[model samples]
Each structure stands twice: as C-alpha cells, then as structure tokens.
Target: MTEFPEGIESGFAAARQIADAVLLEGYVLYPYRASAAKNRLRWQFGVLVPPEYTAQGGEHSHQRTECVMEARQDDRLAVELRFLRVQRRTVERATATGGFEPVERLELADRVLVEWDEAVEERIEILVPVEELMGEGVQQGFRLPGVGETELLREDGTAVGRLVRRREQVDGVVRLKAEELPGPYRAQRLTAVVENASTWIPRRRTPREEALPRALVSAHLLLGLEHGRFLSVTDPPEWARPAVERCRNEQTWPVLAGPDDGCKVILSSPIILEDHPKVAPESLGTLYDATEIDEILALRTAALTDEEKREARGTDARAGAVIDLAESMPPEVLERLHGAIRGLREISAGTPDGEQPWWDPGNDPAVDPERDEVLVDGHAVAAGSRVLLRPGRRRTDAQDLFLAGRTGVVEAVLHDVDGSVHLAVTVEDDPGADLWRAQGRFRYFQPDEVTPLEES
Candidate 1:
C-alpha cells in the first residue's frame, strides 16, 4: 500500500482510482509526442470528439459520457469531475509538392512550407461551350452514363451542365468534444458531437500547434459519501498528497497553457467512501493485478526514471513488489517469460473457458504437446525420429498389413501443399513391406499415433 495509504474500500472509491489509472495509461507516447501516431492508439479510454467535428470553425459541443453512481445509505454522494481539454490553436501547414498539382512524390522537397490555409476551396469550376458534357470522341452510337449535379440553370433557364464536386484535404481538423453531464453522479450523463476520431489520427500539425484538445480523454472524477465526516471528493487527507504527486510527476502531461497553468493534470481516482470508522486516506492502497503489471512492464512505458520509480515505489507497495520482481529477473529469463506469456495470451484471446486453446497442437487434449520448442530427455525428437507404435486397434482387413507395438524409423515428415503435417514412418519389421511401394514403404500418422522410442 505504497501510494494511497487510505482505507478507500468502497466501490465508488475503487472505480475512481481505476479511472485515473486508465487515463494516464497510454495518454501520451514514449518520448512524449506533441503529435502522436495512429498505430499507437493513445488516449484509448473515455474518448470524446476528434478534430473533424470542429471543421465548420466555430465553438461546438459534441459527445456525451454518463457515469452512474449508486446512492449511499444516506442516498447521496459527492463526486468531483476532472479532466483535461487539449487546446488546439489553429495554424497552417504546407506540402512539399509546392502546389496541389500532381507531382512525382520524389520531386517534393522538405524545405517547402505553407501556412495553415483555412477556407481552401475544395472544388474547381470551368465553363464549357456545350449545353451538356461532350468530348471530341465518337458520338452517334456511343452510350454515355450521365453525371453531375442537376445542371444549374441561368436566369434565362439555359442549363450549364458543368460539374460541381468537392475534394478532400490531405490533412485537416474535425470536430471532437467530450463534456460531463450536468446531472448528479447517481445519474450523470453528457452530450455532444465528435465523440472520437473517425479516422486514426496522425501528427497533423507542428509540435507547437499540436493540442491535447478540450475533451474527456483525460477526465478524472471522485465520487464518495458526504455524510459522517466524509471529505470532499476534491480533497483528500494530507497523507495522500505524496501518492498523487508521484502519479502526476511520472505521467507528466505538463500544462503547456491553461488557467491553473501547471504541467500535471490533477484529479483523484474515482472511489466510493463510506461511514465506516476504519476508512481513511492514510490507510488506502490500490488493488493489484499481476496481468496488468506484466503488460505495463512489457510496454516499458512512462515512469521509468529512477526518481519516478522511487516515488512510485514509495506510494505503491504492490507496484514496488512487481517492479522489484521484474527488475531482479535475469534479462534472458525475463525476455523468454515475457515472450512466451505474450504468445500464450495471444493464443487464448477470445477463447471461452474450458476449451482447448488455439495454441494446443493437434487440436486434441489427449496429446498435450508444446511444439514451439520441445525438450525430450535432453535431446529433441523431430525429423528422422525412431518411434514405437502404441498397441492400438487395427481393422480386420488392415490387421496383417500393420502391427501394433512395432518399432519404426521416421522417414520424411511430409507436409501437404496446404500445410498439414504428417509423420512419415517406415515399419522396418513389416512382413508385407515388399508389397508396398519402394523407399522402405512409409506410413503417415498423426503426431499422437507414434511415441518416440528414444531421442534420435
């Protein structure tokens, strides 16, 4: 219980804490991007609107997120809403192609710069001599599919069949908004447009121009009981300061500019505190999840600095424990464990409980084989294996041709063109060997049918 030494055992309290954890989990990229890439998928939780929603230019509101809180025995709860609004300052960016003309990609130079051009016309227009679209090509019998908006007729009623259309920008901002609902936490809701980026967002502006935006992506809130000497959701016991401080310091979303104007976005984790005498800020510690910790370390995300780590350890005993365990592991062992665990997790993804996982070889539990790498009595049994057949059933018509408990030398393990594998074996003692084809008369079997006699 390093960080929150409080007795925040209530459901409301725990939810609050988890909200904070998720907000900062992938809020920014490693090395902290003023602009980030789409592939990274940061700001993954509680997303609101993206830039596209704000495309029309004026202040706009979009997207709604509702958080429902249960009423206490007293039927009241105090919840403080908190989050960051990334302020996007409009600015111009240019293309290396010089102008919009189609130019070879290689011809573009990096030195070319252009200011953010607002109100750029998206369509081109020209006057033609004909009443309808026509060209010099074959005419009388050639059929043409018609196109264009209903011809805009002149005041004289003559039609100008010229086409009108729109072009897409290589890059531009859209509407995005995330606002808290005005009602109580017990039934809170929100409303707005531009809930999330319709398309994966890339670095669309200069580092100086890139914004966190005013949205719910960085929201944090705390909801707890108000009666029986309960503290405000906005305030925590003095003992909890250090834990909060460490969290902001490590996550490091510096306030470039804002009313409070600080680097860190501050908010308490959501929680439900109660009237119990045992509960207090100094006694609170967060719940631990080993699986989540594994992912955080594997990502090697933020909070890695020695100072940050120390601060984190001071606040979270569980985090410290896992950090220590990971730090103490041998590099090679750690790598192997991480890789194998990651792979296993991938195989089990979307799998329901009690079913054979996708990674299980042969799709059968009767033969539990670990195939990525197999170790058999200090040696491997792969190709050219010498195996003994298990005593098993043979149909009456096939009884004389194959024998059970017989030794066989594995020949080429053939793979079907479609990638199915079969262990090819030749029974050296087969009395009918002369009747079968040459090459020692091989037989194919599933991996479960043959047991390795010994390492070969």
Candidate 2:
C-alpha cells in the first residue's frame, strides 16, 4: 500500500476539523467530486434533513451529519460529504443489498425522499484538489452554472436561433423581434427583457406626436379667458412658476424655433372667438390663420407684456384669499342656515289644521295699537296661534330684526299674553352673547299694513 505524505495528512486533518464544526450543528454531508488527473482531487459538499427536524412533536425527531478532509501537503487535495434524508423504501434498498458494495456505489438516490412520521439525518464528505490544498490551505470554491442560447420567433412569424442577439429594423426604428413563448410566460419574459434593455433601447413617441394638436387647442381655450389675457408668456405669474419650470426642463414646446415660437404662443395672444357677440377691428384681434406664421408671431408680441404679468399675479393672490375665507367658515353655521331655509318653506305651505294667527284671516295681529286684532292670510300663519319670523328682505320686521341682514328663515314664533311676539330666526353669524344683542326685538305689523318684500 502507498503511504500518504505528511503534508497530505495535515491537509486532510484541517478538512476534518471544518467538517466536525459544521456536523456538530446537525448538518449532513454528500459525496465529494472526484479528481480528473491522477495527482489531483476535487471536492463537493451537500446536506439534507427530513421535515420532522423542524416539526413540533418530539415523536418526529431526525438526524443529520457531514465530514470534509484535505491532503496534508496540498491544500487543494480536499474532500467534502453530505448526507440526505430518505424514505423507508429508499433505505430498505441499501439494507437489502447486504452492505457488500462500496459506500459510494450504495443504492441511495441523489434526491431526498422524506417520510412524514419522523425526521432523518444524513452525513457527507468532500474531497479537494491536492495541488490547491498544498498551496492555499483551502480548496473547492463555489461557481454558478452558465445559461445556454435560446431559439425565438419574430413578429412576422420567422423563426431564428440566438434570439437575444437578434434585432429588427422597421421604418428607421430598431426593435427586438417577438419570440415564440407561452402567453403568460412570454409576458413576464418580455417585461424582464424590456427592463434590462431599456438603457440601450430607443422608445417610439407616435402617440405623443398625435396628441400635440389637442394640447395646443386646450392652451388656446385658456388664452380666451380674461385671467389668461392678463398673463405674459415671457414672464408668467408666480403661481404658474412650477409649470413654467417643468416646460423649460422638459423642452416640450409646440414649435421649437424662434424666440416667439413654442409653448410661449399660448400666453402671447388672445384666442379669436368666432362665436362671440362682440366684434373688433381687423387689426385688433389675432385670427386662427394657420397659413400665416408671421401673423401669429406679431399677435403674440402685441399681447404679452410685463404689466400684464403683474396683473395676473395680483388676480391669482385675490382668488387665493377668497378661497381661504370660504374654507375657514364654521360648519355649524352652514348647517343652521340650511335648516332655517327649509323651515321657512314648510311654514309658508301652512299646517294641515290651518294658518297661524299672524297669517290667519281673522283676529290678525297688528303693530298698530288701534287695531287690537286684524285678519291675515290664513295659510301664512301656523295654527292661527303663533307666527314665524325669518331674516332676508322677504321676512317681516319680527324676523328681520332678530336676524339682521344675515339671510335665513324663521323657524317658530311665540306670543305672550301681553301681546308681544317672540321670533326664532336662524342666521350665519357666530353664536355668542353678542349675537343676541345684535338681534333686535320683533315688532308686530297690521294685516293690511303688511307688505311682502321681494327676494334678494
């Protein structure tokens, strides 16, 4: 028998130390790669475990182990092994073989066959190249496998090999040919390809080019508005600063050449309103004449000015102030105002019994002392006993006094034995002690003397 060198022995010892460390943690080892040359050795490492190893029950315990070795003189001369879990049927084959064959020639298959009842542990060993083990003290580095070329089909139904490197030229545009693949598979494949090739690929803009005309028409419509007239194309309002910045950065203009051309034309001239009732002189307004580019330029120059830009900014600020005021109004006030209006409509319709005394035809309540009782419209008063007061010009002094000019409708009216009428009116003013003071007392009016006020 040939004796191994001292260096080879030491290298194998180091490999064993590594295997022991990993196996202590329950890892299994598989067969190692064999050396192609007589003087060298290869290494491989693998491991597997049954599902029971990670299961909850104690009855489902499993086992696993692995080992590795390197030649003493050569670091490259190393070997690794990994054991895999297998089904009872798989184990029976090796047992039935009577353990007569070499361990490497055992009946165990490459893949694991798990048994549900219990987890099983496996052991493995690795072998490294002798030359690498001797020189570097380590061997068997990891490597990824390479992918092979694939065949593909073009959009026109032409089949070709090495599709990844193929390209098609159509109408000055270069594009990749569509390859033959399953529907869902092709979709995902195309998405990945497009993402990877985007940096080097040129995109088509036919849709954008078609939409240019519509965008220009929208701009012209904006130009027709009064607010748009005040703005300058050369110097836009501060509120429009962001849009201007975007246009400048994107360089997305209708026309590219000349200072008066491009998107600036949108702010340069008034959009001639053919259907407008107002008429102007021939030279005053710019017409939509596509034939004359000079006319468009001249009109643009006349419309945009520095003063107009300032006016546009001022209008923008004023609009913002109005919006802020509207938003700040209390929600309760609006609700009350709405309720008041609804109540007034109900009162005007009158109750099913009859109208109130204030609106009744007999025993009408009047402000005049001489007329202790007067007749009023039967439908105008509720139940012929109480009167309703409301704010706004249409309401009587009883409603108007309490509500002031803050528009609302009266909800109810109470009358005392002393002949005084109490009015309940809703207004948009803030609710507080001062609100009542701001509201005056209700004054009665004679039936004949009362006059209906027009709606504001």
Among these predictions, the greatest TM-score belongs to 1
What is the TM-score of candidate 1?
Answer: 0.26
CA displacement after TM-score superposition, residue 361 of candidate 1 (Å): 12
Per-residue lDDT tens digits for candidate 2, residues 144-251, read: 122222223222353211122111111111111111223322110000000001111213423322211111111100011101111232354555434333332011
Candidate with the greatest lDDT versus the true structure: 1
Local accuracy by lDDT, each model:
0.34, 0.24
Question: lDDT tens digits, residues 94-118, model 1?
Answer: 2344322221111112111111111
Off by over 4 Å in 2: 1-4, 14-18, 27-76, 85-456
TM-scores of the candidates are 0.26, 0.13
lDDT of 1 at 131: 15
